[model samples]
Target: MNLYKPTDERIWTGREAGQNLYVYQKVEQIDLELQNIPVSGDKTFVLMGYECDEGVRRNKGRTGSKEGPQTARRQLAKLPHHLNENTAIFDAGNVVCVGDDMEKAQSVLAEKVTQILNYKGLPLLLGGGHDIAYGHYNGIKKFVDNDQKIGIVNLDAHFDLRSNEDGNNSGTPFYQIATENSNGSLDFPYLCLGIRNDANDKILFERAREWNVKYIESELFHKQNTSYVINKINEFCKEVDFVYLTIDLDGFSSAFAPGVSAASPMGFSVDIALVALDTIISTNKLISADVAELNPTYDRDDQTAKLVASLLHFIIHKVSLL
Candidate 1:
């Protein structure tokens, strides 16, 4: 159960040995059981916890007067403890505290994720920000064989493909991924879902179109049923051998998830979002997944964190069934 040990000397004194909250085994027992159940090709789930407070500090101007960054850390802290009992916590402990250094943060994340994939396990990442996706994709790219294709399914309000306007902030993950081609080609097929129209930048949209990324706008999901969205996702998944799923909390309606950098008023309802996620997991080719951008300070009584926890549970349960 003692999966996480605070590396920071300053916080090490406060660390309580056998404290279940700071440990992984006690929190994610259920998930581990699922891993034990096994799949044909050595399937495993490794949860990589990268707590990046650095991105927050760098983007303080965009954060405005909100305590978005601190809130993100607090909400993420609850995850290791909450999932400990479920047997789903991956590794001896996959939590890595990257104390605000962007380059080091990316390196640490990339190394851990590469290790996970090397072991043939799915990397379920819990993020510091959307910026983390850049490193996440990079790690996955390193391990994927030349014959295999990696696909990304991003569920977010924004496209996140911005072209480094403010030097690689939260809004430019996909741009980083798309621009970086390893071993002679774009590493994956990046699909974005639940995007809010107003949240997208014109340049980002144009870039997505040019790259042939498939996306479903929020308005389209509202107009159609879950089956329609699922069908679209399935179609997209058909083109790739492995898939990486990224869920940004901002994709949900403000009522359900207000703990995010940019809250979207007319976003997808919780029920619809779950339905979409359920459909995606059913594909059985999810290589790695992450849920990011949860800022607890803007949340209404922990509603957003609770909702995210429940969705995580659902995703784990569904994957276990496969």
Candidate 2:
């Protein structure tokens, strides 16, 4: 099977032509097949798309999120470039999932992510489903030493620890990771923010406790609990040498992000989400991140795509400073 496909360079064109002014104009295109990928003197970010929704399909959810990367790329292209000249951003194409082979697709994604990390590049992955977490996490895990502590910070409504006895679907990635850790791997310190109590059941909560997953409920994401949330995040960051951040679009209110596999009517807003993101990024331990479950099929006027792009913009701008 072909593990990946190169991104179409034409998507990086901007409406207004300015020297290094917008993302489209400033972004560089690179083929991952190449032996040598040129890195910048400063921080380098690589965008890799995982084009598959088989996991969501198996999980009995809506499925057109396979096109998320393409839609997000189009939105990201027109955004203004806020990074310094030395900060390089490269589009590393995508890891395409063929047929219903979620395992193969995820393995390929892990290899690609490991490649970027080996090149000293921070991966900003575009997901086909939240199952991207399994592959994304393993990629970082493969790159870092076994002894080095790594933590997972997930922004989502679900614990994603469902049993994969039937099969590994979108809801079983974290459980899979936890299972792997139980087999004598490194410590799995997971912090989940913006968890909606209604989305997860008692069994899931039990699983979370069994795995010792640290999570903050969606109700605690308001101004009154801002300091408390930040303090929790800080404490989590302090326990790990590295962090892998994953954002599920369903974690946000349907008004802000309607195009997702699972819609959370009582989800948190983007403002408070940004606050949590800022706290995590400030730790300077984030190695890579991904945004998942963006199904454009249910989007209203491209609202969710714009939100994802805007978040990407903010992340790039902030990471550029580091």
Candidate 3:
């Protein structure tokens, strides 16, 4: 597979695009024999892909920067098609882009994610935005029975639990999930973590109170050490059979991760964030994971992307050890 350079501006197409974006060399085909690895025993596979580019412009504006299509495609190209030799990784490529139809974009994402889950492999979804979580959760809910509750640990600077007042934008993922589940569709235990105080809407806060969802504000990080955060997460994870982990880059301080839709002044330090993630992965119940809301435009010389990539590496490595 062709790996695009970090600064490349070319818009790849056809087989080149597929090879550049989708196929990874880490693991063999989904049906092929798994390679032996010392860490996780080669049982885990990763379905890696990018989705939801329609809101890139809006998101860029929100973050006070501009990483357009070319930058996004370039950054994605730099990601490993496969992270490890024994782990099969699917690079599902860019399923949506700007100027594309919204319904079409959503449908494509739903279809691709559904295919990824059908293999029964853990999906390591790279994001175009947090809204992609709605599609991700939508796909997961299809395979799980109604009685089997899945827990979600959303690490974000903002509570994305706002109602879809203007439709399914990037800001309304958790809200969409909650709305869907309320009607007897997708029933899951959801937790929002690392939220800053200033980022939430009054309505979202009211809804969170009404739903009794457990959330840890960003202020809590300053008030306690990493162990405190880890223990809180562990308590939540213990109540559910499976867990979905979503990390919004904005959850980190703008100094650490400035390339997001809304960079928060008050967020976790990188070390503390890593400690919290370590605690989560150690639980051995993370079924699917995604890192979202990474807009390279506002990033300081690609620092945010590199940080996100490192986080992904840590997640895979730590999970492999488990």
Tell me, by TM-score, which candidate is best. 2
* Candidate 1 lDDT by residue in tens digits, 1-322: 2223322212112235565654322323222312342232423465555565355456552232123322332443345433323344343233433444565666667766776677666677665677778778888878888688888898888888777756766777787777776346544488888877688778778877878888988887753577778888899889889888888877888888877766877888877777777777888778788777767656789777667666665676577667
TM-scores for the candidates: 0.77, 0.97, 0.78
Compare candidates 2 and 3 on TM-score and give the better one: 2
Q: Model 1 — which ten-residue stretch has the worst lDDT?
A: 5-14
Tens digits of per-residue lDDT, candidate 3, 1-322, equal 1211122213322234434343222433231123221234364555334445555343333632223323433344455543444554433344444354544555555655556666656677677677678777877777677887778898887777766776666777788788778766433477888876687767777777777678888777643566778888899989987788888887888888888777776887787777778888888888788888777767779777777767766786688676
List runs of model 1 lying over 4 Å from the truth: 1-43, 56-88, 91-100, 182-188
Spell out the clash pairs found in candidate 3.
22-91, 24-81, 27-88
The global Cα lDDT (0 to 1) of model 1 is 0.65
The number of residue pairs in model 3 that clash at the backbone is 3
